[model samples]
Target: MARALPLFGLVLLASGGLMGCGERTAARAALSPPDRAEYMGIETQLLDASTVSFIVRMRGARDRSDVVAYARCAAAQYTVIRGYSFAQHVRTNVRRSGEIWEGDGGFVISPDLPAGRRNLDAEVIVDDCREQGIPTV
Candidate 1:
């Protein structure tokens, strides 16, 4: 029984070490936002009276989808701030360099909701983003 006791202890230690070997925990942690200084930012430029371009930058975010969503949320809020009821997506480009992810999106705002285009209602989008815990502006 003495020898069996030592073998059991060794097995327990080995199992504990194995539990920490997987990358799942590391991947999950990587998705979380970094410190406040490295948080996401959006810069908007008006290309015309009804069209605007947005550049979104996020640090320590590897997923392009999240970066693009931030840009969309910005466009939605900008539309509302401009007194427009809706925004139509014109185009978007996404890229990643080092630890930062960037997305550029162009939108056209209209007082009358556009049809037959990829569009979103500013009020509805803002509310949806709020419910999803996504920051907008």
Candidate 2:
């Protein structure tokens, strides 16, 4: 009876493993990893003395988060361009048309660090962006 039980368990396990092998392999092959983000370009607009708007476009983004990141990188670099050391994120609007993703981000540039959780030190962010292979304005 013990030998029969072991043989039955092995048969069940083997059948289970074989049953879905073809389908599982096909599904995995069909589901390829998303392509890496391709940054298209960036446009910077100064809204006010302390406020700015960044319009960023990219391709191959997996989601809106990539768009936001691209915009943030632009804002960080623009802050440095204006001789500012910090930037606060106000908001970002994201949209996609076909393969191109666009993000319009609002940021406040400051010589001093802003009092917000969404704020970033311009120099640090630029370095991080570069490390991540993301471009800056």
Candidate 3:
């Protein structure tokens, strides 16, 4: 009976390990590291009443896809100018910084009022870009 109990326990342990293999695999797949590009600082400048431009410079050893993604993320995040959302304001030149692997491009925000040099919103956008897996560049 003692030997039988030991065998049963061993079998249970083996089965438990096998049963969790799928879950472990799935978890690893989901958490797979994002192909990250080298991050660079974000540069934002105000052109005039109808425009605010942003540039993100990034470098990657393998792929520039992250840079492109970063550009899109920036465009989406910066759509809001001042305390207003893009839905409440005009968005122009809102695009990728430039061609993929070339340079990234952003747009000028046409705010309801004259645009000024506001670093606070730009700071928030930088944080957002990092969060979205977009390289700072």
Q: Which candidate has the top score in lDDT? A: 2
List candidate 2 stretches off by more than 4 Å. Answer: 1-35
Please give the distance, in angstroms, between residue 11's alpha carbon in candidate 3 and its true position after superposition.
52
lDDT of each: 0.67, 0.75, 0.41
Order of quality (lDDT)? 2, 1, 3
Pairs in clash, predicted candidate 3:
52-108, 56-137, 96-105, 97-104, 97-105, 98-105
How well is each residue in 84-137 modelled by candidate 1, as lDDT tens digits?
988887777989888888889998999997874466777766655554445667
lDDT of 2 by residue, 33-99 (tens): 2357778899989898999999999999888767877888899899999999888889999999999
> Using Cα atoms with residue i matched to residue i, what is each candidate's TM-score against the true structure?
0.68, 0.73, 0.40
Off by over 4 Å in 3: 1-34, 61-65, 87-104, 110-131, 135-137
RMSD in angstroms, all models? 16.7, 16.7, 17.5
Q: Which pairs in model 1 have colliding backbones?
A: none
Q: Model 1, clash count?
A: 0
lDDT comparison, 2 vs 3, better candidate: 2
Pitting candidate 1 against candidate 3, the one with the higher lDDT is 1
Question: Residue by residue across 1-137, what tens digits does model 3's lDDT show?
Answer: 22221211222342454336676556333332245555565665656653555565555423343443444345435655354333111222222343323334544443342343221233344444555455442
